[model samples]
Target: MTDAIADAKRAMRAELRERRHLLSDHARETAEAGIQAQLDALIAERDVRSMSCFLSTTTEPGTRKFVTDAVARGIRVLLPVTRNDGLLDWAVATTDGDISEGLFGLPEPVGELLGPIAVNDVDLLVIPAAAVDASGMRLGWGRGFFDKTLGSMERCPPVYAVVYDSEVVDEVPREVHDQRVTGVVTPTRTLTLAPTRR
Candidate 1:
């Protein structure tokens, strides 16, 4: 059963990733703008002082503008630095200028390393995902980095996954170790999920 679920999730990831890659630059920019607007509203509503977010890839929902703007607002922002063991280390991303390519071809900050547990210090957490179901189950990349990190948190703050609007679905293949998100932020809207059967 585990293997079948993994395989199904693998196929879903590929399809979602391919769809993201096919988005045009103009479409992505427009989506980013919409996402940024929703993000700003959420941040203010929640009074988020610090957050851990991912440095989005070109094909992913763009987060550069959001990160830059957050930094400018004096909101502390941390980006993940993938480690050799598949766990992630955190680092300050005070600005958008110091990012560089890191493990798994993802962008990361060059600031002082804050170790893995630094994620616990944030008031909010913004995770990257290929898709998220209406019940708040997130479908991340095959790697278990975010899953492990979230599982390790003692008092996890509100966690939100960033994805395109279409990626939000009614269901997603989930394993026992998979972590659930509190909400999902898309380019067009923010879905604050109500509790559902797990």
Candidate 2:
């Protein structure tokens, strides 16, 4: 992590954010269709219902649609609540209508917060990241929320960070605290398989 590398990383992130905001009106529609189709195939298979999933939100390229669709199909949906402790609290969102934003810009359940659940119960976690590499190392918003929550998992629940195709990179800065995702999914590719053990 030299000064030059850090500067380059910051510049890359800024460029990405700007590009994401400039998507053509048709870009989102195209992405939604492609994303939904890929996810549908994944859901149709038997693996989706095996365990609860933590469905997160995104600002522009976000895929709340995928989460709601899973709920409609009776797949268990877990939403993470950002806590004062700067860690994530996992609770079932139940349905699309069950969500609202918290004090921070992040979305949370409007109803009872409900106690946190065991990470082992989660089979697949649909995480959000600013960037993800081929090896599954993800660069997320520096708040360290996902990193903290992921630290609690007991070697299970394949993590998949959802991002647009352009966000996938060859490498991202990784720290001891940064969590490695199990895979990366673009709007088109259902899964960019990460080299990790199940």
Candidate 3:
């Protein structure tokens, strides 16, 4: 990627992070509720049995309740554990275990460690993102963990980046290593992108 593109992504991420941190508690709660409703429809429509999803941190669209509810509903949920190499490993999020803080200040599942390839078994994915564009390109935090994971898949299942509705924009700066998602899920709606060979 060119320096200009990299710089643009960094700038955008910083701006978005500030805006996300500024969201009021009430607004965040309302958005979380809306996201749960949308998730219900998505699960039914896709007949999602096993899937990978992230545990949301504060300043991101909340997914804690949804993760717990999904586990209760007997859907297998895999949450990522960041490895030392910046690759992600998977762990099952059970209903009763205490969550421990992992790298990058993200809360992680305290369960059996499933190797990296475990994510490939899921029927779908609900990943965290700062923003996603109309064409499915996702702008994530600088780290590139999800980008590496997605790119390594031989036949990746449908992947959706969860973001606020307003973060769905006309475009986001992209680079060769940046993997596009299958779609994006906002608090209000799920936006599907046309299938692309990449």
Candidate 4:
């Protein structure tokens, strides 16, 4: 059952990737607007004094402007420094001018790399995702990076995953190491306190 489910999920992602580039201009514009609106609302409501968010990639939901805006709001913006040791480390820096491509061709900080910090120290964590279900289960880019890091954290901080409308679906397969987000902000909706059965 697990194998079949995994294969199905992988296939779904592959299919979507092939079609994502074909998105109509109207669709793209609408989605971007909705995402920006959600980000603005979230920013206004929170203190954001100590928030850490990942620099987004093309495959994942985009949060580049969100990160920059956070910095302008006097919030601490953090970038993930992927280490050869297969653990995620973070560096606190203004997501202003230091952004450059990293190992996976994803944008990351180009400044001093800071060491690991407790998960509890982060007031909010912005995670990337391919999809998220109503149960708050986040489906990342199939990389075990987040799973491995989150598996070790004791008491987790509030995590938010950004996703497009289509990716905010009804169900998704989960693994043992899969961590759930506290909420999801989609291009079209903010499913705060995701209900288990939504």
> Which window of ten consecutive residues has the lowest lDDT sum in model 2?
50-59
Writing each residue's lDDT as its tens digit, candidate 4 over 6-44 gives 897798678666666777767666665777688777756
**Residue 92 in candidate 1, Cα distance off native in Å:** 0.9
lDDT of 3 by residue, 54-142 (tens): 98898889888999999999999999999989899999988896788999888898888999999887888889999999899999998
Candidate 1 TM-score, C-alpha based:
0.95
lDDT of 1 at 177: 90
Candidate 3 residue spans exceeding 4 A from truth: 196-198
Better of 1 and 2 by lDDT: 1
Q: Local distance difference test, per candidate?
A: 0.88, 0.69, 0.90, 0.72
Q: Which lDDT tens digits does candidate 1 get at residues 16-80?
A: 98999899999999988988888898899999999988888899898889999999999999889
C-alpha TM-score for every candidate? 0.95, 0.83, 0.97, 0.86
> Cα lDDT for residue 56, model 2?
45
Off-target runs (Cα >4 Å) in candidate 2 are: 1-9, 50-58, 96-98, 195-198
Error of 3 at 101 (Å): 1.4
TM-score, ranked from best to worst? 3, 1, 4, 2
User: In candidate 1, how many Å is residue 185 off?
Assistant: 0.3
**Candidate 4 off by > 4 Å:** 24-30, 193-198
Name the lDDT of candidate 2: 0.69
What range of 10 consecutive residues in model 1 has the weakest lDDT sum? 189-198
Question: Against the true structure, whose TM-score is highest?
Answer: 3
